[model samples]
Target: MSNIIETKVCSEIGDIEGVILHTPGSEVENMTPGNAERALYSDILNLSVAEQEYKQLKQVLNKITKTFEVKDLLTEILEINEVKESLVNNICKSENVKPIKSSLLSLESGELARQLIEGVPLNKTTLTGFLSDERNALRPLHNFFFTRDASMSVYDHVLIGKMANKVRERESMVMEAIFNHSSKIKSKTLNPSSSKHHKDEITIEGGDVLVAREDILVIGTGLRTTTQGIDFIIKKIKKNKGKHSIVVQQLPSKPESFIHLDMVFTLLDRDKCMVYDPIIMQPNKYQTILISIDNGKVKKIEKQSNLVDCLRDLGMPLEPVYCGGKKDIWIQEREQWHSGANFFAVGPGKVIGYARNVYTLEEMNSNGFEIIDAQSVVDGKIQLSDYEKYVIAINGSELARGGGGARCMTMPIRRKKVDW
Candidate 1:
């Protein structure tokens, strides 16, 4: 029950103590063919299959560290009388269904928790409501189960996202309230909408922000996070007055797979990085921009060949492991779309990723990370702690369809500082 808080995420390769996660709920079924793509999903998922895949991740995590479910945390926070009333009211008002807040408040905790994620059905008692095809008053949180995107824990402070869509805004609001009010955790939070220092133009998502090192951050700017969002991060760095470096990578505009930084770039180990060959490693039109801040001053802003090159200049040269294992470019493109490059570091040398990405895993094996089945780790047949470097490869066929990988499905709250 440590309440330690952090505002800066210094490194990605550290021991994770606790992480926040949301297991898929009934809200996933509420979505239909009508708004699936708009919700950022290609098609409606079979909740059963998705849940099974999520369980593998959940089970594996349970073996290594303390895991807190988002619903449980939300339910606990709602028990506080002041927080309960204020949160429900604020949520209702924000979602444009203020009339229902009173009704929501009277419900018991179990029901309320279900409704929050599964959604409150669009009351169709009136003629206007009956004619309207809208499915929910407070629409189902189709993306809540993918907890990694809404908000992120960077160092001691939580970075509350400015969701690209209004439908997901409540997720950020809820996460912020949790970090601020929860007695279980101690953390300061940075938010675009609530921060006085940040202009209203700023918009950032946890998916686009990656803590590459204690002094380095790799960010993606395209659809989800805008230039304004990057500037907002710079504002935080400016105020901190430390030697901080930010590398901004421009991603593709279409084919949503390239939406977040983790999609194309992620830390595998101290000296290795998983990368999409075309966008990150090979030469293309994309630009890698570097911004350096020293002692509250805009020290340097320059263009580099790529992220690896920029990092090399800064003394952190990472060996780029191609997603498709240096084979044909077509395979690289196909695998990258399914999140081959997204690997989550459970600790300094312990990582997790999809075993389906054979080439990607092969590359990792070539780089000296022993491959181990996630089930072995969970069932205690194999000990992850026994190895200095290993990857808990999990079955991710169904999970990858949700447009994420191990890194995209997690939100780490506490990680030990890396030696680097």
Candidate 2:
């Protein structure tokens, strides 16, 4: 096989080639009651629980794909002269830690890497530094564990996210550098803020965008991605000569659980999907609009019944599998809040998700899926590839509290094309 990795993700369900993941660090543990919400966490995760849960995910993924750690990728890319200098300068300036740039540059590669994600401690010598309660001169990227938000892969190109929150902006910048400058792969990078067609109002996050097929895309709009963001995607799709379509679904903003499209809906197979019943099945004022692009032009834009209905009309039909086992609405709501619908597909009929959502797992098991544990799969007690289709549920108690699941944590860069 060639050493150069190519970006070839064409479907949500495909044999995996490479995936991006970030190992949780002290940065995750650095959260306190004072800045928990600001750090994108309602409660700080117990590090031990998060790490154990994460190990299961890592081991399972390692068995299947060429897994890459974010810190290692960032460190490798930062070793380049121009890239290293520019990234540090930009990061320091943006976070207003210019005074520490020289000190930061002096650190060895290993130490520097840890500091970037875990954060740099305040000097505490100067009056301002002494009184500053902020542990980091540059704040920790507490949400870096959720690698999907910083960058996304679309066909052979990478879309560098423009975060709605400034705290996560550097995560985007770091991801952009890894995709653009790292020796890992070759792919074009698109920055929404600096794109020639970028709009002043456009705000997109990778968490909201789901790649269904080579020509079809499903996006959720709520807190992270907006109408302008969807329009921004439309402009990109309109430039392509081949067949392409964009399905935009508006998401609710109140309850934080409705953060991304995947939070409420995600693909389980070519013909099946996991969904939060209330938001997706039980219709509300939220709209599901489909935009058709015909030969680089806006051909049609119309409302559809729901996301499942829209995808079915477009010929990618998927039967809806409700989160929380399809029983009480209360059970559905409770589990949905914990990312019950969020699962990542490794291939058609083969997927992975959190095992804590027992109700959700029960639904999948009843639907002809052989449920397996992550450790079982990793230890060879269970074989994922042996079964044509299976749901591999991994434990994520503390990690789930971070408000994500398998789909939210993984950034799949490439997958074998489906027979479809």
Q: Pick the candidate with the highest lDDT.
A: 2
lDDT of 2 by residue, 97-164 (tens): 89999988887766788888899988988999888878889889999989999889887788888888
**Per-model TM-score on C-alpha atoms:** 0.96, 0.98
Per-residue lDDT over 105-131 for candidate 1, one digit per residue giving the tens place of the 0 to 100 score: 998776787788778987899898899
Report residue 108 deviation for candidate 2 (angstroms): 2.1
**lDDT score for residue 260 of model 1:** 91
Model 2, backbone clash pairs (residues 3+ apart or across chains), number: 0
| Alpha-carbon local distance difference test for all models | 0.84, 0.87
Could you tell me the C-alpha RMSD of candidate 1 in Å? Answer: 1.7
RMSD (CA, angstroms), candidate 2: 1.2
Best by TM-score: 2
